[model samples]
Each structure stands twice: as structure tokens, then as C-alpha cells.
Target: MSHVANIMLSVDPDDRPTVESLSRWLQTSAPLRGHGPGATGRVGPLGGTTGEDTRRGDGGFPERDVYAGALDHADLDELIAHVERLAWRQPEFVHLFVTDQEQSSFRVWRFHGPKLRQISPEGREEEVRPAGGPPDIHTRFALAGDVELLRDMVVAAVNWGPGPAAPREAVLSDPRNAHYVDGWPRPGDLGLVALATREVDRWEPAPVGAAWLRHFTEDDPGYGFVGDDVPELSIGVDAAQRGRGTGTALIRRLLRTAREAGIERVSLSVGRDNPAVGLYTREGFRLHGRDEGEDSLTMVVHLR
Candidate 1:
């Protein structure tokens, strides 16, 4: 699971001082902790195939210095966000390039405060969703009256992302899925809803995601049922609400709640192709088994 990733960053010449500081910190930070001999660093005008054409088309931005290094995927993600934050704080724009060990997939990002976005190879721009949850996001216990909300979230969870979602009725009508939300908030059912505010002064926040637990008997085990005693997790964040760490926050908090409730373990199922598997893995969920007759995996996390 610890794959290496190469990161390249281009920042305005005026920000060289900041880049230098960041370089010094990177050499000794938690990011490079377990790597054998640490990493190498070099500051120069942006080179490489990906940067050459783009830098040429950048007009009069001048030849900004670039910083490049490689690190473990987990630490790479953290380092990328840290670099993005530094870019956001800079007086001008910054460009970040990330690629896997084989250099097969390249992602480009531009950081400019409230205008952050990722640039595709085709020159298409899309909003960049950071990993950590923002300050405006709030979490609250899911109430019984939130059935409709949970239903919608269930659909989002099933689809995982932008793929076509089954009609709400059809999705919930299935006995398996229905058990997740039907008779919401039954005794021993625990859950939380995450709400986010678009504006700082906004008094009310819109619900963006939810996570809940349901118990099952051995005779009728859930898709990810590990034992009759372990609660199966059902979680989903609105499509528009993902990538901001809302799902992560919800899962982490819900797991803590489970531990406090005397539960020793939690279980869940995710599709083999679902990107959320990475998130779940990072949250300490380990593969238990393949769900029979399904293209999904059953995962479990020990709370004790």
C-alpha cells in the first residue's frame, strides 16, 4: 500500500523565500520519516515534458522555480495538501504536478486562494476538493425525522460517485438496502449527519453527508457482516460533498462512538472499483472477505 509518488511544484519567483523554507522543513518533516535515506531536492526553472509546454503558454509569468521530490502515497497526499496551503497563502499563483511511481497518471493543480482547480491533460479545469474538512462543516446526530435525507444519502453511497444512481424508490425497495435506512433510528442504531455552510455568516447549514450503523443476526447477515455482535456500517456523502474529507470525518467520529458504546468492531462493504476503498483503508479498515455473489469486498475495523 505504500507506493511512491513524485511531486513537482512551480511557484512565482517572488515566493522563492517561502519555497526555500518549505524545502528545509520537508527534509526533516514527518513526511520523510521512514524513507530509507530521505529525499533529494533541487530548485530550478520548471523542466520536464509536462511543465515545458504549460510554462511556455503561461506568457509573462517568467521562469518560476520548481521543487521536486518523491514520497510514500499516504505521505505524498499530506505533502500535496501542505504545498497547496502554502500556495494559497502566497502573493501569486502556484502550480503543482503529481504522478505515480510509473508516471502513468499525471494530475495538474493550480492554487490561487478561492480559485483552486485541477487542470486535465485536455486543458479542462475542475474544482479541487482538499482532504481535510473545512471549518464550516458541522456534525450532528441523525434524528428519526431524517429518513428522507438518509434515503438520498443511501443512493449516493450505493453509486459512490457520479455513476447513474438507481431511482430512490428502487434502491430502497430492495430488502438488503432497505434494512439500512428503514425505521430510521431504531433502538441501538447510531448515526451522524454532516452539514456544511457555504457562507461564514450563514446560520443554517445544509446536510452534506451521513454515516450510520445497523446490527444483523447470523441468520440474516448484512453484506459486510463479520459477526452478530459487530455493527455493519452504512455511510454516504453527497456527490457534491465528497473529496472534502466529510466522509472521513463522519467515519472516524462514528467509530469513536461505537467504541464508547462497548462495540469491539465495525464492518462495511465497498465495491471493488469504488474509490472510497482507499479512504476506508486509510481509516484502518482491513479486508475481511469478498461478499458472495457480489463484486464488492467486506471490510472490518477493530475498535478495541
Candidate 2:
């Protein structure tokens, strides 16, 4: 009978000590980190571990090491491929290690994930798994008090990744669902409020005035502007309360107000690079234009 064994190993410059210790430990237990006859291993550039020969040096620093033995060649090959893919996706260079106890099967793999780049002194960027390419924005109206719930609803609208699916119907059916309608801030709804700031003098407050004051005490304190005429969609969510449809619910409620007001359009602005663009786009908002001075995109939705 053939024996099966599997292990996962990773090395990262970001995790210097851990990688070094793991490499040394694997070496001591078995001849997995160094070269020898009868022992199987592979080494190459971060992404080139899929071919037959494992020993093509690339003259690169932090080369990945894979040690394998005592397994059908096919299984070992698959393991190497999987590890290499994972490594290539990591932000920093990484090496993978695997070991099999029963038949003494072991292997190592390496790859470098997307690298981080600095776009400006204050801005840095990293590649994210594409979420359905560019996002599509939709607009909806919501009530003032239901802002929290609406945000959650919007988040539930899109499948962020392969986790448990969110409860779409339940999110939509809730009477509190806000962003489902158009022309937010119905005739008598409270105006959205802006947190008092030095910039307060820069823009005039809505003539109808703000009814309720809500401040997002997250990384940034965002003010909500609720009123009968002004658009009142919530932006950002509580760090702990995000990803459960709060943003969607908030937008839906605002849309409901808009529809009631007989308003056929609603709009908001977000920084071009804001992650919230994904959620806004999914909710039916679209980029109508851009504000170059502010580096913001003016997104709008038209209601029928």
C-alpha cells in the first residue's frame, strides 16, 4: 500500500525569525533544505517551480527550497504547484516547506506575491484580488435612523469572497432596508449633519438644517448629513460592525426617502481609490464625472 503524507511550509522576509527558524528546524529533522542524492527538492525563481527539474538557480536572494521523498511523483508535483501559486500571491517573498511522516515525504516551494509600491509620500498601494473587475455603482434612498442597517445591507449585496453567503432576502425584506429607493431625504426627513470641523466655514449647511447628528468614531470621524433635500447616504462603517450589510441598509433607506420625495436622482462623491467604491458601485451608482482638485469622483444614480 502507498502511504500519504502532507505538510505546508512558508518563509517570508516579513516574518524573518519565523522563516529562518522553520528552515533550520526542517533541515535538522530531515535533509529538506539542502541538496543531496536520493533526497528530492526544488529551487528556482519565486514563480518557476512547476517544471520537472527543481534545481535551476536564478541568482536571486531568498530562493525557495522544497524537499520531497517517499510519495508518488504525481502527488508531490501537485503539492509543489499549489504552494508556488500561494507564494506568488504573497506581498513579500516566501518559501514553502512540507513533510510527510509515514513515508518520510517532504517538499518545499517558493513564490513572491504582489509587491507593495509607494505612489506618493502619503499613499501606498498593494494589489488586491480583483473583485469582479471595476465596480458598478447604484443609488438608493434610506431613512435617517436606519443608516446602520442600510450599510450592512449593501455589503450583503455583493459576494466579497468565498465565505458563507449572506442572507440576501432577509437583508432586503427588512423594513429598515434603506438604499433600495431613489431621491433620499424626503420632504420632511432630517438633514444629514457634518461633524464640526475647521472646514465647516468652507461649505454652507443645508437650508433646512440637520435633524440628527451621528459621528463615525472609527479611524475617521465621518458626519452624517440628513435633510429633506440633500442626499444622505452613509459612508464607511464601524470597524467591528462592517461586512454584515450595514452600508447597504443605510443606502436603501435613504433611497426609499428619495423615491417618496418624487426625486429622480441622487449623488455622492468618493475618493477614487476608496475601497467603498466597490460597495457604492454594486448599489447602482456610476461615475458621472470627476473633481480633479479634490481627487474625488462624482457618482450618481437616476430613479425611474
Tens digits of per-residue lDDT for model 2 on 240-264? 3345454554455445446665766
TM-score of each: 0.55, 0.27
Best by TM-score: 1
Residues 1-304 of candidate 1: C-alpha lDDT, one tens digit per residue = 3345677777766777777666665655535312334533322222233334445554643466677766442244456566656643463568777764423456787754555466754333211122255554656678887888988888887776556768877888888888888888788799888876454323335788889998988887788888878899999887777887888888877887789789999999899889999999999999996456778999999999
Sequence-dependent TM-score of model 2: 0.27
Which lDDT value does model 1 have at 7? 71
After superposition, which runs of candidate 1 have C-alpha atoms over 4 Å from their true positions?
A: 1-132, 199-203, 290-294
